[model samples]
Target: MNAPPYLSIVGWARNDGYTPNYAKRLEHSIGFLVRQLDRHRIPSEVIVVEWNPPPGSPLLADQMNGFLGGTSHASVRFIVVPPQFHRGPRGWQKRGMHVNNAANVGFRRARGRFVTPKALDTFYSDKLVSTIGRLDLDDRRVYRCDRLDARMEAESWLDLADDELLAALARHVVLRNGRLTHSIDWKMRDLHTNACGDFILMSTPRWHEIRGYQKDPTVLCLDSDSIALHAAAAHGASEVHWQEECIYKVVHGNTHAQRVATIWKDWQLKLDHYLILRHRRELAMNLRVWLNYPRRRVRGLEEILAPSIERHFVAKAARYAKNDTSLVTNDADWGLARESLSDRTVVRAAWDTP
Candidate 1:
């Protein structure tokens, strides 16, 4: 049998066209990745988790095959998390992508020594790929890098030369030196949580030990990525910020942009509200301790008083954001490991190169 690959690249997307020319962006990013892996001779496998796919639309697997003209030198797998698993917490209606959950699905099934979860619309620099290819990364560290936002038209992306593309990407550095000043609460100490879901690399074993991302279904879509990073830190994985390497993200979706803008706009109001909630939660915990409440009563009170807060709330709390203790939120069956999902080997090389 063939050995497990050196790296596993996992990401999730559906064909809802969340961004204009979403398919084209996926094609460009995935094509770039395959080419880079082959050029570096990096033994890597790519896993694209098509989570909660829209019905009646063509499958992303088939679309990706068509994107590469049904061929690629590097190994690629398309794992489908069918519509049935799209339901939200407590029977809440299915909303947009369950970003963390989908990532967990791909991470669980990844067969590589080192696993990196990324977005389909982001392209990795050759330097970054080469660094990973060297395979000298320390297993005890979690690697992160800044995301440079490049506003490249999806359809026009394929026409750019490598030199022109990299030059254009260098002009827009969204998160510099691991700082997104306005993205998180000012009271909270900053860590490299900016566009983290786009590129978070660690050993496959470390990822499993952290139990993937927080599985809470109600945590706002934007905050979960940072929560995962905080959880990693809590699990005693040292942070290694890649100042030299960058992941260029193609700016297209308004969801993330708008969310950040809204937060920044109402920053003070949200901070006050979060403070109020935190006080109540702390009061309840103290009351429980003072009264020596029964375990069941304590749990009930805890559930009532301490609701889950946003990413910034975690940033302010050391229990989850620092090394006091390990934080493994998910159970042993994380990433829907028990489910019998469809895993397809979608693209196999039919040509020399793209």
Candidate 2:
């Protein structure tokens, strides 16, 4: 019933071995959030839609449960829902769409004009925070930024001072130099763009208009970064003239100087392969057309793929209509039913992790 915030930063996390320095990284992220609260300027809030916090791991809920418990200025606000077992599309368990599913949970609670769905294992700068909270950014365009990746060791990160984090954020690690870059590097990859989870700053209504994240039982898609690209494309969106300001990212794994190469290499290759390669020219053409000058509405991927999916459904219907009695027909019928409704329980983002 209170006033809305300027921005609502949404993300998720789980305490598994897969994430390195999660406590520290998340602690830094929370600290960054606290420092960026500009009441007269950029009033903001943090929404953490946590799904599977492992035992012994720190919950943002417990950290910021004091005065501003349900508000944005709190250490964090949560929509701590349990994970549903419906991992079908793009191997649901690994594609991060589940975390995105968690994002939808927090998104429902957002009263801010803008929301940047991201991951918790990363830390960012105050500049990046302000940039994301822009109250006047065009709703017609999806925003993205390049992130600088780094790593650290485990310690009581919650105690670190902001000065140390500021110094660390200024540092960068690129594969070309094998050390921190002498200058900043944050640009969209040429004509073919690949926005990451942290890169996007979408308007709340735009997020809703796009209908959250895309899903299919068989597709490798929807990380926080690429969702905007695909959604914009599906809606006949603007070309990718993304911001060029560098954003810092904590890698959250091994601090082994030697492992730095492999760690950053894997990440770079991930961006290159997924955002650049894969569909090659087809995706490039699609993105280029959408991203082109004087951008106007055009046929989006939804238009192209909807019929394909419908054709599939129609074909299956014909089979069933033809008295086909097989697992394929039964499974198709079941899949259609499942997609129409929400399975997991829904709750307000202001709720605690119960």
lDDT against the true structure, per candidate, is 0.69, 0.47
Clashing pairs in 1: none
Say what the RMSD of model 2 is: 12.9
Give me the candidate number with maximum lDDT. Answer: 1
Q: Name model 1 segments beyond 4 Å from true.
A: 66-73, 90-94, 161-163, 171-177, 180-190, 253-255, 260-317, 348-354
Give residue 217's error in model 2 in angstroms. Answer: 3.4
lDDT of 1 by residue, 52-87 (tens): 888899988987675654333367889999877777
Worst 10 residues of 1 by lDDT: 293-302
Candidate 2 per-residue lDDT, tens place, 103-137, comes to: 55566566677777766555556566565545567
User: Which parts of model 2 have CA positions greater than 4 angstroms off?
Assistant: 53-60, 63-75, 85-97, 132-134, 151-159, 175-192, 216-224, 233-244, 252-354
